[model samples]
Target chain A: MKFSKKDLIKLYTNLVRARTFDMLCTRLLAEGKFVSFYHEGAWGDAAGVGTATFLRKDDILYPHHRAHGFPHMIGKGVDPKYYLAEHCGRATGCCSGVGTVHALFEEYGILGQSAILGAQFTVSVGWGLAAKKNGTGQVVVASFGDGTLARGTWHEGANVAVLWKLPIVYVLENNGIAQYVSLEKAYPLKDMASLAAGYGMPAVVVDGQDIVAVAEAVGEAVKRARQGKGPTFVECKTIRVTSHGYGSPHMVDGEQRDMNMVEELKKREPLSMYEKNLLKQGIITKEDIEEIAKAAKEEAAAAEKFAMESPIQEDASILDQYLYAE
Target chain B: MRLLQYNEAINEALSEELARDEKVFLLGEGVGVSSLATTRGLVQKFGPDRVIDTPIAEAAITGCAIGAATMGYRPIADLMYSDFLYTAADDVLIRAPQWRFLHGGRQSLPIVFIAGSGGYRKVGPEHSHSPHSIMLHHPGLKVVVPSTPYDAKGLLKASIRDDNPVFYMFHKALIGMKEDIPEEEYIIPLGQAKVRREGTDVTVVAASYMNYLAIQAADKLKGEISVEVIDPRTLEPLDLDTILKSVIKTGRVVIVDEDTERCGFAGELMAQIMEHAFDELDAPIKRVCAANYPIPSGFLEKFVLPQPAQILAAIREVVK
Candidate 1:
């Protein structure tokens, strides 16, 4: 389970990149730079990055709707420029500016995400079927929030995925809150991974704040899936450091979060915690951290520039073009 | 040419497509047994890998079809009854249809959602209903409602080959109906309407089981009213051109639909006819559709559903 020093650095770099891009997008949204809504992946970076950083380019990923899948896409090695362009409604966007948050990158097995939550549970099963039929050893990782577990699709999808032993890994980012409802009020069980027991699928829980821990747990699940060992449920108990989405209240159940609790949770902030761990273990020095932070900021700046300069779609004829296959 | 029952025609199309393409697979709750008899004995030929018997989960079945299609495999998801489409509304109505378009047309979902549709089986409100109009409201889906065995086989074949999501709804009442179809491989292209009986007095546009009723009504009123029965095999890629031509010639139109009257296919067709041939109309277009109420079970269903008598009355009214 021990990652090589180089792999660790790569994971660290991806986490920083995801956080940087998310922060930039959130700031842009607040300034009205873009009209699209954003769900910040502020403290939940490791759940997406660690689970996706080691995946093969051909491996399919049904990214979680949180942060609009910025961390997951970046972890899978896709450049953020086109995705940024999509949010800006530029013609150069991945979906030709038609889909702001739902972008497709077929080469990396990044098909798209549904606006309706919990849809990935069922759709990912099909990808698993295809991978098994093709004998390509391509695994599918379907990520969703804790709130998505309440959907009926979770039961239906899990039952089949276990029955057929489809090559899929269901990663749950249990960030305590699903929009407004708290996790305690949503499900009866403390650990959502127990939901997998009804289907007899292997399940595990990992700390969402630790990128290395998430990578190790999801890495094992992905390996099992690739080896045709059926599906596995990996739950990352994480935190939502901000509101459900940008420009939304931080209240859960019509009550504001305790300011003291919010401050305490911020101390376990993923970025700073990982940086401190890397520094303590001698895995990365102060100067290395500074360089990585600077490079991520520069990359985010370049992507913003690319999106801002891209042309906006004006002609109405393009609307009918992608409606159906001729 | 060989005479085949509607269900047999569907089975033949599925068998041939499974053999024609390796990527094509069948998945449903009872696909191996196929209570509808359309998919019976398919598992024995294609084996379990292709002829998958799934849990009674509509959302998973449809979601799997969408997922498999995105990965370049054509999936035929059977919902048992088309009325059950409501169970997987997100996947059937939203995901399958809009996935390709919303993703900027980079992906094509080559999926066929086949199910038994319409009343006459007296299977209660849940099983005996044709919700094709709800599908029509959604733009991306292609809908095929075949009234005859020949059209059933040909249209189902075409739907499997299509590079988009197609809902191939076979009327439950027409399952036993038989017709002569060519033995050789054939595909009835979607969006083409068949003029079941050509006439010059009044044009009757009907679909699925209603097409059969329209033909019966035409025969019953033979000498009095010249009814031109136009069966639009595929509703989404509707051959409005053919219907308009008939409307222009006859100057009168009557639409027969098995679905409810309000916001039904009959209403949509009538509006389109008026829009295109307003001046040519000899009278206001009439429609014979099921009353706007939940289709009741038992003999009461007959009262709510469209009947040959209603088709006759609509034809007589339009001709007047």
Candidate 2:
């Protein structure tokens, strides 16, 4: 479970890419290039990116709707670009231009995200149960915001996962908010980790701002799951870097942080934090940082080009592929 | 061509489907124990892996079935009674049907939610109600109500094979009524309506066991009133063609459903007929259905459900 510089570097680049993509989306929507206004997991990027780094290519992950960072971290090659295009309602998107943000990459075992709060919980457990039955050695990760825990499916899924000792990890990105309301208003239980403890499963709360910390916690849970220790719940206490949607909703909030506070958080950015740690340990040179950033940008740029230049989905084929009747 | 109970037809369909496709499995309360008789001898045939008897957790069973379906297994999840379906509606409406659309059509969920609806032999309010009307309100969900043995077999096969999640509802009362069913496998495509009987006096749109009552009422008034009975097999993507054709021929209509009369499934049919066949109508549409209340315990259940007499009364009023 040793955390290496290369791993830290990879995780940092992905987090930066997630923020970059979210920033681009904001500009796109404001300019009307993209019709929908979407916000990334501004507060939950570290948790998403870090946990994703622990998942193998074949391991499955189901995300919440705002989990763009998670998909980018675990996506196979140029798939995330096409997926983003699809989410933006572009014709050349990953879901064959049909779905935008909730696309599933079956090849990479990214089970897609859900618009409904806790619906993915049971499905994740099901996938874990299937993998366990087939002896596939694959662990399933079901990630959701703190808001979704109020849903019945969460309890139903959690109870069954513990009952069967299924290989799954429930990731709770508790950014202290649930939509317009904060977490305290939505849930009576102050600690989400305690929520899973009642189901006889281990639950832990981690600092979601630190990529290595989030990664270490997720890696341990995933390892436990693969070893058939059943499901674990990880509650990450994090903050959203942007507003809930396309623009900064907090810009108008009188309780907004001053420029100095914003700058402080920026200095402690997930990527910068991970890079600084690796640099301090002398595990890598400055050239390594430059190469990774260059490679990540190139990958993102190529994916965007492919997605933008791809052909639009035909109108006639809309319903053709819906059912597997062939 | 022989008489079989409505429940028995469902049993036959399940047995045949499981035997035919190894991918098809049953998961529900008492399914392995053959509590509904639909899974009779299924445990012996497929064993525990396929014929799973689950705890009384509808949400878990439905959730597990949806997950299994995603892994390419065709799972038939039985809700012992239609009333119990609400326990798992989240999976049926939110997860099962919406998966493909949400995933940008990258995935398809092929699962069957089987449940018995309509008045049974005094099974009380919980056991006798039909909830397909409520389910039909949701898009992407396919609702199948089979009224006969042949239809039960054909539609059940179709539902098992369809890549989309389907809610297959059967009337407990119709299980005893048998019809000619071929041994070979065949499928009735979803979203199609069957013309049970054709006449020119008035059109009678009925679902599940109510269709049989409609047919019976139509037969009783054959010489006096030529009643056409149409069964819209799939209620969600309702077969408007057959219904409109019948309505146009008769220029009058009566829609019969076992669900509640107020904003029930019959209203959906009535609206469709009125909207598309308005110009051809000779009179206002009438619906014969269960009263706007719980089915009630004991004999009251029979009184609440739409009977042949009630359907005949509606037919007479529409035709007159």
Query: Residue-wise lDDT of candidate 1 within A1-326, one digit each (tens)?
Result: 87999998999999999999999999888887665789988888889999999999999998888888989999999998898888888888898888888869999998777889989999998999999999989999999999999999999999999999999999999999989889989999899999999999999999998888999999999999999999999999899879988989988877998778878888778888888888898999989988999999999999999988999856578767777887
Every model's TM-score = 0.99, 0.88
Q: Which lDDT tens digits does candidate 1 get at residues B71-148?
A: 999999999999999999999999988888878778888999999999988888999989999999988999999999
The C-alpha stretches of model 1 lying farther than 4 A from their native spots are none
Candidate 2 structure quality by residue, lDDT tens digits, A147-225: 7888877877888888778889888888766655667667787787888878889988998888778888989999999
TM for chain B in all models?
0.99, 0.94
Best by lDDT: 1
How does model 2 score on DockQ? 0.49
